[model samples]
Target: MFTGIVEELGEVTRVEPGDGVTRLVVRGPVVTGDAKHGDSIAVNGVCLTVVELSGDEFTVDVVPETLRRTSFDGVEPGRRVNLERAMAANGRFSGHIVQGHVDGTGTFLSRDHDGLTHFAYPPELSRYVVEKGSIAVDGISLTVAEVTRDEFAIALIPTTLAATTLGRNEPGDAVNLEVDVLAKYVEKLAAVHLPSAAVDNGGGEEDR
Candidate 1:
């Protein structure tokens, strides 16, 4: 699990394409300071396993499925990515729970001077978003300030602007988005119980 708190902005150094997978080498001195082979790291909200490590750089392989689902499908060298080490067992949860699993991709819409940034929600994923809920964008946990049919907004502090790649994102860019897992579970439970509760209440007609 991760907290979605970005540790650093890393750059992709190389991308080697294989038959069905691609190997990515990223330069992140801070995140690799204590990282080891086989460790899990969040690269732009996607959990990647370390396959190799060199000075200030680590490598991971992205499979076809991952590429198709994430914005990394056409990732190239020099692309900046948000990097974060997996949360330690006794670590503080500075941000909300992030699984490093991108539910879908959202398009960067626009930004405001008052720190409010907007992202266009994917139609299939909009049902998972709600006002005041937690959402992870490019691996940074942010609270939803507003929600609409096609977009959602969040307030980004100066620290976030400086610490994550989100600060550099432009309109029309694609971003990885993960909705709150808890909210998804709650919705599932309500779907199962609400109908039963209605039936127990005389189906709303027998009572009258």
Candidate 2:
């Protein structure tokens, strides 16, 4: 698991294609300072296992499924990606839980000078978004400032604008988006028990 806190901006050094997967070599000196083979590193919010390490660069293989679901389908060398090492057992939880699993992708709609940035939400993923809720965009955890049927806005502080790939995103760019997993779990549980709970409460009707 990840905390959605970006540690550094890493640069892709190479992208090699295999029969069924693509291998990426990324340079992240800071995140790999003490890294080892098999460590988990989040690249643009997608959890990738470290397959090899050389100097400040590490390699990871992206499977077909991950490529299909994420914006990494056509990733190329020299691309900048948000990088975060998995949180340590004793580390502070600075951000919300992030699974590094991209649920879908959204298009950058607009950015405002008033700290509010908006993204056009894909129709299928809109139901999981809500005002004041937490959402992960390209692996950065942000709070939903507002929500509409087709879009949502997040208030970005200067730190956020400077820290992650979001700072460089322009209108029409695609971004990986992961909705709050807890909310989905809660919704599922509620759906499963609501009927029974209603019956136990006399279906909202008073009984003498």
TM-score for each predicted model, relative to the true structure: 0.91, 0.91
Query: Which 10 residues in a row give candidate 2 its minimum summed lDDT?
Result: 199-208
lDDT of 2 by residue, 102-168 (tens): 8788889888897699998787667679889899999998999999888999999989899889889
Indicate the residue-level lDDT of 73 in model 1.
85
How much is the lDDT of residue 128 in candidate 1?
78
Query: Which RMSD does model 1 reach against the true structure?
Result: 7.5
Tens-place lDDT digits, model 1, residues 15-49: 99999889999999999999999999999999899
Alpha-carbon local distance difference test for all models: 0.88, 0.87
Stretches > 4 Å off in candidate 1: 195-208
